[model samples]
Target: MLDFTFTEEQEMIRESVREFAQKKIAPIALEMEKTRQIPEDIIKGMADLGLIAPTVSPEYGGQGFDAVTAGIIAEELARADVTGSIPVFYLVQASWGHIFDKYGTEEAKREVLPNVTKGKWFLGIATTESDAGSDVAGTRTTIRKEGDHYVVNGEKMYISGVREAYTRGGGHITIAKQNPELGTRGMTLFYLPLQSKGIIPTYVDDLGREGISTGGFTIDNVVIPKHYIIGEENRGFYIVHEGYEYARGLISVICAGAGLQSLERGKKYLKERKAFGQPLAKFEALQFRLAEHYTKLSFLRLGAYWALWTYDQEAKGKATRFEVSKAIAMAKMFASEWSNAAIDEVMQWQGAFGYTRECPDQAAWRAIRSFAWAEGSKEIMRVIVSRELLGKEYISYK
Candidate 1:
């Protein structure tokens, strides 16, 4: 009763993406993880192939693909290497690029998005502070009006691609308090460039996703042009939320892809690796475990597609925010947790080799582990579902 069908174009696109990722990305993926540097060549190649801005309109030098197509791209990229697909790149394009096209000033779009699509600039979001992750409205960062410009001063920690964007001539769509009295409602989003005076980046070493740098930015009275603001002043919260939803949606596909890849690797290993003159896969215990894991992954994949479809429908006025929110949160939760489980199961099949730092399995394991906490944590996703499904009356203070 269930259908898993792709259009001819979609099928060919998926195959093309898979082939490109494996042939061009896999060879140096391990090295990138070990060094935490995204090669300029890889970025340029993706740009040349028109893979950088899949969702942006062609007017801005993008492909203007639908959400499902974008999801397929994420899946294929993460299947080969999560780091190679590059979360920052996808998140920025899907979140910031589209948001700019929709809400930004014409001048801002002309100045920003074309460079983003050309791979000459890397775009990222700077919302999470050292104290504010899920609670973005509680952030302490402040932006004050100064004639035609705004002075931004605060520190954003655990930010991804700070150094890369700075070195590569891009910037983040930063969120900051626009009106202190308005609290959460009085914030604003700014397309703040890294080259701006007083903007500084400090990189951090992380345990996984070594190919991508995670760090923080310290703005010492950084000045941004007033024209850089996106949407109306003091309504930045909604803009940020919109961006978060898109990011969470695509990241779910990335997690699902990782799970699918892990399952494939495990099956191959079980078939070839033997113990006691028999294939380890011959054991009923292992076979049953893998079966259950695969079932969950299949469910997660379906849920991800359902969420994407719901989001698209909502964007077209065929659905509501509450419906889309629930679907997106549910998909993100299932995909992240189950993908980690699938990865762990695959790693177990490899025994000690999976734990070795040099092995691809180990690199993938660490990279996928980060997904459990990226975008919004699994706990946050649960809270979202609970709030929507149970409403205020069911929220427990007990």
Candidate 2:
């Protein structure tokens, strides 16, 4: 038997998040672009609603929700936030917070998850560097043990929430090579506090999602205690992918929500705006595009949920990692492309207004563009799908 409907609790969460996002987040979303930071009130509001890191356990001050429930919250946030800032903020914390709760030492969990779930701190994943984006094995960062502590030295670039974590008191679930000869097998994962000594922070002027800073930092021999290590030593390469898969699933849903919201605005505009003395909706060309986009996005939405469901299945020992990876890659591969296309068409429908900052879709277009490379690049997604279909001997990178 198959049930596509959401559970009662899931529906309630969607309604609650939708109401809060529409009433509280939408009005202030555009302002974040100018302010270059999410307002404190908005963070506090998310905290009150348990939207910050709901995947974490209740003992750690989270709602302890699963991946699908997290997607529901992310979808609503995307629907309300035209700029995509809030969705980025919510998804990263939720994804990495789940990782920390599951693998982090009890001491680290007590020290970190509480503040993150409360919105007083930020939790992010930082594996990308100037030299390595999708190639995790190419990471030049090094972490080596020194008696009771570990020392990390390297630089990470194009990371989200660096400034937020640095200023607001949190860190990234960072990966660094413990043995250069062992390659990916030598990697270790740990919580790297942005404010620690030997850490030098920098910033970049991004194209969109101004509310959340996108930049890098140089870690100069930063020392961390053993308790901050996530999972076992040299086992980070496997665990980090779990977090990436989680975030990728959420990104797929966010794209759908943003694309659909733009289509809604387009729908209203087409019905009311007149062209050649007739409503724009009367045009067959435009009507066809609208229907096609809606259909494609509807499939993307279904694929995203299916990927998340597969992840849950894997957790329950009902699915394999290869199965989950292939499913998630398929879902996310077309997410940014199709969503961006839909938003672009909506922008075109609005004439000159869509080109301006006043048009929400313009902001959405810029924000959604980042996801094509975020988490993992769309190219990498295709490679994963192919690798799964083919044997390991056919892997492109190997």
Name the best candidate (by lDDT): 2
After superposition on all CA atoms, what RMSD does each candidate show versus the true structure? 1.9, 0.6
Model 1 residue 88 lDDT?
A: 50
- Quantify all predictions' global Cα lDDT against the true fold: 0.81, 0.95
For 101-146, candidate 1 gives per-residue lDDT tens digits of: 7778888888988999998888888899989998887788999999
Candidate 2: C-alpha RMSD after superposition = 0.6
Error of 1 at 20 (Å): 0.7
Error of 2 at 45 (Å): 0.4
Q: What stretches of model 2 exceed 4 Å from their correct place?
A: none
Model 1 / residue 201 / CA error / Å:
0.9
Off by over 4 Å in 1: 1-4, 82-88, 392-398
TM-score of every prediction relative to native = 0.95, 0.99
- Model 1, residue 155: distance off in Å is 1.1
